[model samples]
Target: MSETNPSDAPSPSDPSSPDAAFAQAAELQRTGAYPEAADAFRRLARETLTLNVATNLGACLIETAEFDEAEHWLLTAARHRPTEPVLRRLLGNLYVEMGQMERAEVEYRTGLAFRPQDAGCELALAGLLLSLGRYAEGWPLQEARAGLNPGVVPPVEVSFPEWQGEPLDGRSILVWYEQGLGDQIQMCRFAQELKARGAAHVALGCRPVLADLLATAPGVDEIVPAPRGETVRIRDYDVWSRYFSLPARLGTTLQTLPTAPYLSARPDRRARWSGASGVGIAWRASPTGFNARNKNVPDDLARRLLDLGATSLHPEDTGVADFADTAAIIERLDLVISIDTSVAHLAGAMGKPCWTLLPRLHCDWRWLRERTDSPWYPSMRLYRQTEVGDWTRVIDEVARDLQARSAA
Candidate 1:
């Protein structure tokens, strides 16, 4: 890969170069000022007296989200230190982001051979395996990701026993929320299941915004919203489970993804959203397309979806659009059409009929690898990318389906 240097990329012959630049570059890397570090390294190109500086410079590029340039720099540095374990892991992560799953697996496996104890590489390789639906091989590795990062809640350790069935004689069980609202919604299914199993008191901790939504979850005895800086620490409970981890613990497979809708929205909210035909809509979101090579949709597509003469409510239209009124806009909707975001969860939880838009690679545990409908959300349908960035085909298919469904 060709290194992209500024037009005035520094060379060793320059007499005016400052001596502090080299030292500053080193400091920048240590301080995590990766972009500046990359820039400073490029500026000190003339002072390139060692391979260590080049490796550090390449790492800085990786941190700065310059993958193409990062690859070039690291590939060059790797030639000098082909035996460095970090380079292989870094290349593997880059491949993961680039959607080169097979290549990433090789790189990760290669790095693990040299540095098996590296938790980071272990976590990445496990995640890749799981994303590819290679579960038989991935589950053991996936365990390494537990508590690996900060801000992640630790998994509950059961010393007494994991309740099999009808444990609720009167014992309380804690239900831990994980990740996003969507994750929580999907996981809430376990709360009801826990209740049925005799967990009489099921305490839940989740984001405050979802308090009302969670209130509607059948099994929760208490809903605690976690505030910034304040954590929900439970003193005791007979059992515990992270919502998303429920399936894995319960031995869920692609064939059995808890298809029935376990959550239903408030009767009032449901009534307001009912009509002859309604479709929930969610367009843009961060991590919008982490799968399918990640194409962030433009506003134009939202306008097109709206123009389909179907009832449309923006999942993101909180004050951005002069949405006539939230209740009114949502009330007359018959179905939901959404991206893989919180709105999809909302629609599913509401038990409203919905068609979830999907990216090809998809998010982890969406494990609906090639299916058009998800077994996880009963009324929700899926429209997937035929090819990367090919939303037009997906849209046309959706349009045709809508016409046929409406006609039927």
Candidate 2:
């Protein structure tokens, strides 16, 4: 999310005016200086508690993770402008940061009530519901993701009509990719479900890196490798839909989800790691992109996993070219332990034992809340932080479990 600009802030014609100070604070926020922005906004709020000042102050506080202060300012703003959906959205985000999912859901719902077309709030509420395993409600709302900003939801240009719940018998459907590699891995299992519903041809359009790996997934008749910056023209498909949307289209609920192994490693690649054994570990998500900082296990804490005789599965350390290579390495390992990344999804998709470590803050919805096992991947176990930014306890618990399993 980009910094909030104070559209109502007065013109900065006078250098000494509160308007100028507000402008300065907004500039600081735009430049990623949260502490300074919060301070400036605080001073401005003391002088005059306008809706603009309160909302901007609340936004800055949220960025700085001063949740208590953020809640006060955001609530003040929301109370003043009860019909303003943006204020409710901001309050919802602040509650999410504070790990108050129930409160967050209330804020999101209130925002939606005020403005049903608020796509951001819809997506946020969808995530919260899905995380709580309320698939029936979540999946439908998740379609709002396509209405988000182009940067968040990449543009998909296709001529085919989106496949709603229409009968798939003797019909062809293209499942085009969206989101990160981990998301693609998680959602690709739906291809087999489509086949079960009698889709005559199930074609998957995916990133080139995953094409080889996902090709092995059952019920996929074709793999269309989506090259970066190049338009992929798929022909002879009766209908098309975003890959993630399939779960909703298929009427998936927690109990009805297909949880079987749907992917496999190539025999040639598996042979490359034939002698490999013991645990495989990945402690970091991709360093680039949104939420990378929150998803990573600290280097110091990660070393503890290495000390337990696990080998690093990072591409830099393993020299893996793509997911296919990673899947092969996982096939040879007895178990995999990873942060919330593609590796965990890959292991789970291949029906390998995997332990996934989840952060308390901004944890992905797929992991759900306080769950020890994943319904999406039956062989997967989840280890989550009891408190924010505290991996020491999580690592300690994993270490003890590893030792006990070794002794057994």
Q: Report every candidate's CA lDDT.
A: 0.62, 0.83
How does model 1 fare in lDDT?
0.62
lDDT of 1 by residue, 1-408 (tens): 222221111111223335577667767676656678788888766555345456556666655557688777667766766656667767776676566778989988887887785676776787787666665566556656556644554455546454443346678866666666666777787777666656679888777767666776777888877764665555677766566455555555555555565555455554443443455466665552233224344567666767776544553544422111333344346777777776677677656777877764334545335576666677778777766456777778877887787788
Q: In model 2, what lDDT does residue 198 have? A: 92
Candidate 2 clashes: the total is: 0
In terms of lDDT, the best-performing candidate is 2
Candidate closest to the true structure, highest TM-score? 2
Q: Judge candidate 2 at residue 296 and give its lDDT.
A: 89
Residue-wise C-alpha lDDT for candidate 2, range 99-184, written one tens digit per residue = 78888999999989989968878988898899888999999999999877565456767677889988999999998888888889
Poorest stretch of ten by lDDT in candidate 1: 4-13
